[model samples]
Target: MPRHGRLHIPGGCYHVMGRGLERRRIFYADADKQDFLDRLGETLARNGSQCVAWSVMTNHYHLLIRVGDQPLAKLMAPLLGGYAGHYNRRHHRSGYVFQNRYKSILCDADAYLLELVRYIHLNPLRAAMVKNLTDLDRYPWTGHSALMGHRKQDWQSVSEVLGLFARGLGTARRRYREFVVQGLEERDSDELLGGGLVRSYGGWEGLKRLRKEHVYCIGDERILGDSDFVERALAQDTLKVEQATQRIQAGWDLDRLIRRVSQYCGIKEEQLTQKARGNDLSLAKALICLWGSQELKLSLREIAHRLSISQPAASQWVNRGRKFCRELGIEFEVIDS
Candidate 1:
């Protein structure tokens, strides 16, 4: 069967995992790992995303990221692509570095944030990369050391993770450590990995019990959440799909969108395509970028070409446009079909 399209919800938290091609080692030395981390830090910083927990193993890596306005793909593309290029060049090897597109599970933060933190940080110990929790505290590859105050990573959201445990920094760290210790006995958790109905219900036994009780819960492989959360997310996604379809069927092409935005913003259509900077122009361009991609199903490359701007700039505008529309109560009126 074909894979499901990645579900992109702005500001959602995701548990992301990537493995090396053919189950080979992605990192051969400390330098390789350091390169990957450096790239990740830069990518997260530029994209305004937060990494609460991360672990880099020999063949794979995991990240718990709370995304900002842009889709998660914007952040992952550069990080994974840059690292893969760097790895291939340094090793004098060619071809793909990663097994495939990295896996990402949109998690219900309230339910799985702390659990995922513990699971990701404890990866080193589970793989025997570190002898024990004490060693894991000092282990450099995982974010555990940073949380434990044994190592410093300016990029990792140490405070955010610790803040969840306690108000005071020191007390929070202590409590966080205790929490990690308590989770050491947990075997590989399939529920944390994400799945459809079976994993969402907890396991086979949980499913059986629910079935016996005549209880039904919605689930999706792309999402890790309770029935309500899954239903809400799916509903939102369906609405977006329907809206996009309506826009396309209504003849919402790039030219028509540009003309409409220009008319709404009270600017000449030509001004939007020109290199200019002003509040009105910026907002107009942002709307074009946002609506063009979301409603008209235009790619960033296509949007950038139309606006005469770089692809990266187009992405930034999409994020800005989202915030602008939300804060200012801006809405686009559909043109007559």
Candidate 2:
């Protein structure tokens, strides 16, 4: 099968899983788990991400992460590489540690965040690494202990997860534990693991219902969400690709992109290019920055120089521009190309 491209959306949540090669044990000792967590913490901090839930198992691991400024690839590269090197050197062995690539499923956070949290935290207990919920709470390798206040994990986003269950911290923790306890009866959740339409719609019956209702969804092994969410996510990606191709084929340059953006925003090129401070001017500049950097694949330094702004300022504009375009439902077309 062909490899699926990773769907990278900033501020997206992902359920990421990776396993050791040949399904061998990845964490041989307590120190190895700690080393992996430490590396994870550092990488997440550097990449500006938060771990909603996580657990280290004998042969594999699971992470629920809300993507930050950087792409998920940037976050995983250093993490897996550093940990593998550490593990190998410590064990006096040298070979491939992890399997091919990690499985990353772009998830609907609102739908699956709590479920994934419970599913991931209970991995240790389910794997016979712990006896019961009490033991799982203090298992030390899972985020469950941290959420229960039995362990301290400065890196984990405990407050946000607990905040979903209740208002008070104590009550929230109690309720969260009860919620997890209820799921103990759940058999292996193959749906949570990833299948195409079947998993996306919740099950085969749900998928059949959708077909019966004439509701078709864009499903992928890389995404888990509702039809609307999947469609929008894919549409956004398609827009990016089409825009890039159109701009490239039209032989667009910085000047042409700025002119087009200015016209679309009903502003003048001078007002957009010159140093101005207003919503309109900012919006125009942001659009220009996004087009120049993303579609044109121009460097931030180049865009900054063209706009007479600092590199940092141009970079900020690019981010804002993406949001602006998304909000405005803006799409670059080949009307005049």
List the global CA lDDT of all models: 0.79, 0.78
TM-score per candidate:
0.64, 0.64
1-337 per-residue lDDT for model 2 (tens digits): 4544576777878899999999999999999999999999999999999999999999999999999868898999999999999999999999999988888887756446677899999998988988889999888999999999999988899998887666699988898998899889878676677633334454445776887899875444456654434544554544644345555677888878887777767787777557667778888888777667656656656777778775546756766876787797775552234
| Residue ranges of candidate 1 with Cα displaced over 4 Å | 1-4, 197-221, 238-337
Model 1 C-alpha lDDT versus the unseen true structure: 0.79
Candidate 1 residue 261 Cα shift, in angstroms, is 47
**Cα RMSD of predicted structure 1:** 15.3
Query: Any residue pairs clashing in model 2, and if so which?
Result: none
lDDT of 1 by residue, 287-310 (tens): 888777655656666777788875
- Candidate 2 deviant stretches above 4 angstroms: 1-4, 195-221, 240-337
Could you tell me how far off, in angstroms, the CA of residue 137 lies in candidate 2 after the best superposition?
1.1
Each prediction's RMSD over C-alphas, in Å, is: 15.3, 12.9
